[model samples]
Target: MTSTATTVPAAPGAPAATAASAATGASVAPSARPAPVPLADLVDAGLEVPVLGGRTVRHVNLDLAASAPALTAVAAHVGAVLPYYASVHRGTGYASQASTALLEDARVAVAGRVGARLDDLVVFTRNTTDALNLLASAVPGETVVLDIEHHANLLPWQRRGRRVVVAGPTFGATLDALAAELARRPAALLSVTGASNLTGEVLPLAELADLAHAHGARLAVDAAQLLPHRPVDLAASGIDYLAFSGHKAYAPFGAGALVGRADWLDAAPPHLAGGGAVESVTVDAAEWKTGPERHEAGTPNLIGAVALARALAELERIGEDARRAHEDALAARLHDGLAAQPGVRVLRGFDDLEDRLGIATLELERGSVGLVAAALAAEHGISVRAGRFCAHPFFDRLATRANGLRVSLGAGSSADDVDRFLDALAGLIADGPAFAYDRTPAGWCPRTDDRPRPSFA
Candidate 1:
């Protein structure tokens, strides 16, 4: 998916794009609309099409906002560290010391990537969801969340018995709305997502951070979507704390982190208390170790953290500006192409904003979103997400509250992938209403080779 805008005006005297709608309540036929080139087209051209069924089946993976495929450099970095794997900051063995150094190095690497202070501790957990949970356990007092936040960033507060104030889609006026919300409720922390998990529209992080600080509240961002595509300057952005999953960042590891000030994290009990977290345990009396170790208990997923660090380092090496440009260009291409379609309503930057990520979630005419999604995956071999995308509140304001289809891309994507998705989508829309072929498992269709293929035929 790319940012889309139609350059070609209605062919001379054909009809204004809205003229048909004004005359009749129904939209114009999508088939009559011109096709726009998508980013999938560019990406597919460069990638090696895997051979399946005696023919090359080029995969159009548009789910990168959920998780990107690992880079070659990141894989190599992980392979190098595998031989020296050992417990960090615990064992007296040489491997242990080396591992300890590497773990700290990983912290520094992650800190640098996000523009945090070097001394800041990056406590590793299971994934972004886990990282946010860790923060939830650490922070005390009432939490304020936005309507657009993913559940990982919202539900944790509920579990902690903290009062959570859910705000509406501020849209262009998020900061003002947040400031007013904070004034009404004196908050200790504000948990927010850096971008919408579903729409790929960026939240105003810097502005939000500033607003949170003015009201004497600390802000923590779930950068699950931001880390893979944009440069997350935690310090510069004024975000006191940040969390993102390694797997979602293209590491595909169990490791994730809650990185920020040590005071709040240190004052709170260990999220998962055990071995490395304690200095001395005597049933009743226990002394905890200093720094990130106080939180990371058990053996720790050493390999996972190393891989995640490598992934971030690779992103930094490639340069954030360059990568964003590549993805933004592709997204713009797709957005323009799709926006021209009569009934296609893109769930991103429509009226006010111009810039956005490569990811796009949309609704099509005359079809169930689930059916359309399944058809794209099965018939076209193009993977796109459909439904609420873990964002129910965001959908509540959308024209289609039941569900909306998502199309997201990432660093690994090219133009061909975008094109394939658009091409597949065109066919799916033209087919009219989408109906589940049978009572197969959800997200399943008569497929070639995906996890547990179901027969759509």
Candidate 2:
């Protein structure tokens, strides 16, 4: 299951590749590829917690779709830059110059990683929610979106005169409905998720792009889920805009990007109105800068950008072919194992496994999801997310239950983790949880079961 696309060419203005610049650009002299790290080698793999018999087992984290664990490479890059930290774009000091250069270089690195066009502007924001909000604010006319989108993609456009189209029964039919809706009215943008947060099924981006373009609408993809598993090239895919977060891509939390055309973004008023976003301020008004700086009104997150760039660079160094094969194999194993279970139903949008990433959503017939999830955490030391996964509309429309269990994988997930998760689920299905559970305001919690909470030590 290797991807056929080669690594994208470096963006102009990026540092020239050399022997020492192996992690920043694509032109490292051909050498042996770095060996991939297993899930057990991650920073959180050694975590231990008490289970049913009061015995501790290493925690098995199976929640990659929500927020993936930071990669060791990204952490190292953050640590390396600690000494040179400074206020970017303001100070003329030595560290400031270096940090500023790092921030700008990181923008170029991320843009290149996503195959952004030469004219596209990459604006770093807080997360996918913030990025989409910025785009929503900039959209000139009514926006069209699918009902299956994450809340981040769905909520922002509601106030902007949006038209929501409910998906049809089948995937292809859903696209046809969307195309018909786009035809019904003049639209400024058609926003969609690259992959469903619930089912992990990928959308037909190229086809959707063609449909949007044919209907005089620009396509914006919320790639928070897709970027982790596969390649998303803006130029090649004909995507007008792409929004994704750093945490989902093995970078630390707090940074995301909105990369796309400059026309809409430039024409709209600044997303934030103050400080660095301005060219000069008069008593009555202030002049705004064009491009990304126009919206980034505050001091930028230099460290976050550097860490994200390093993570993207590391992914490139590992090669998509190797990463995809590893994830696909584990996904197939997990899917097969789940299918073999008596009452387990693996929720999916498409018939083919290739249309999905390594994510599984399960609906159990015999046990309560809350009890199963709580028992897995307290009695089995396995972690998974059980909920609507932020797509309330999708769940309300398709799922028999409001919530389900989602097990997602990433670069760090290994055969051991997947096996452990399946074993836990099998045990749960064969026999109910050993402990009683109750749903509270927070979520499901153990009832009268007192186990020492694991410390980060």
Candidate 3:
């Protein structure tokens, strides 16, 4: 199913378009037509996951916090465009030109999805890790990242000897505390997540942004959790930069982006050294390209960009607000249901994990969150996640067991999945490995069993 919206338009001085440009290039595009239809119905109607043994027709996949499944529309769109793919901007050939146009157009498509500025340069990188790492190279101040950030956002700063500060446990208090800290420090940069990886907390974004600006600091949001399920108005949110991964945003390709503040990125040295990033390379010093090209070194992943753009379009058509409300209700169901059980502690210092959708990470007890995750998958067909996720410092602050179980959801998730998962968890902790998970194909599938599949790997 193709999307009806074509929302992006040409800038003030853009040239008129023809059939050829429309076929494969960026031009002043029109707005997307309203899509009364949503992909969720199609996903719900027929979806399948293969296994080595007797395959279950309807398996619960609740690992969306880590990575979400693709919309069928997105998959079909990518499949159709795969054959036309070419080495973008590598040559003067027709295919190369076509690919380059589509690649740039993907930027416009992404901008429409997020309501970003018309001229905002969107650089497509491999994933959230690469995108943020690339952006970090440009930041000119002592960086402030919360202990709540994923390792992807944190490690890059530490490796560079940049000053790092871990924020308070609660989101509201964290910002209040940071205001005073930033006052004492030089003009600094703050990096935070829109929705946290664990606990599914949506940070105090508007309030915190205000505080950051007050302290002469700007905030960069890791929207890896927020972008897919909800609307992220970067301009209104008062964030300086916005970062997110596509795999978490209904497109499971190696693609992600960091958008905003072109100057900081323009001033810093390029993250990767390569051909496309340079404007003109003599045998001596190179004349660097301007705009996003300055940062986006090497041959770009044109197909991944196309796929990500389409995925964002699909989400926009379905209406971000509606998706958030539906998924939020589902997350609440799981939270409340789990809280009723004995020995189960649902940890949330703020309101309902900050109005997040499709993610609910909690601790069953102190010692074996990993074990509980395994048991849930083995005995039943439920697929949830465990371990500290990637937010080591956040988990450390809350004093959770180093590894905790994280049960998440997606656009494809059902109430039945959560219900079955809750039932499975109740049984698993008591009985221990009901199906002998170490021995079965379905039981020991990619992410579950007697042990967890290595997360970092």
Winner by lDDT: 2
User: Best to worst by lDDT, what's the order?
Assistant: 2, 1, 3
lDDT of 1 by residue, 1-457 (tens): 2221111112223245443442333333333223333221221333433332333466677877766666766667788888899877767999999998888888888888888876677888888888888888877787888767787877888876554444444455656677887899788998888877777777778778888889999999999888878878877888989999887777876788878988888888888778888889997988988778888888888888888888888778778677877787677667765765545777753344455677788876555667666666655557777778777765666646477888887777766666666655654554431323432444434333433333562
Task: Report the C-alpha lDDT of model 2 over 204-263, residue by residue, as the tens digit.
Answer: 899899999999999999999999788889999999999999988888648999999999
Residue 112 in model 3: lDDT: 67
Q: Provide TM-scores for the models.
A: 0.84, 0.88, 0.82
* Reference-based lDDT, each prediction: 0.70, 0.80, 0.68
lDDT of 1: 0.70
Flag the better candidate by lDDT, 1 or 2.
2
lDDT for predicted candidate 3 compared with the true structure: 0.68
Q: List CA RMSD, all candidates.
A: 7.3, 13.3, 15.6
Give the winner by TM-score: 2
Per residue, candidate 3 scores C-alpha lDDT tens digits across 397-452 of 67555656788876776666666676556544433343433313322322332433
Cα shift from native, residue 434, model 1 (Å): 12
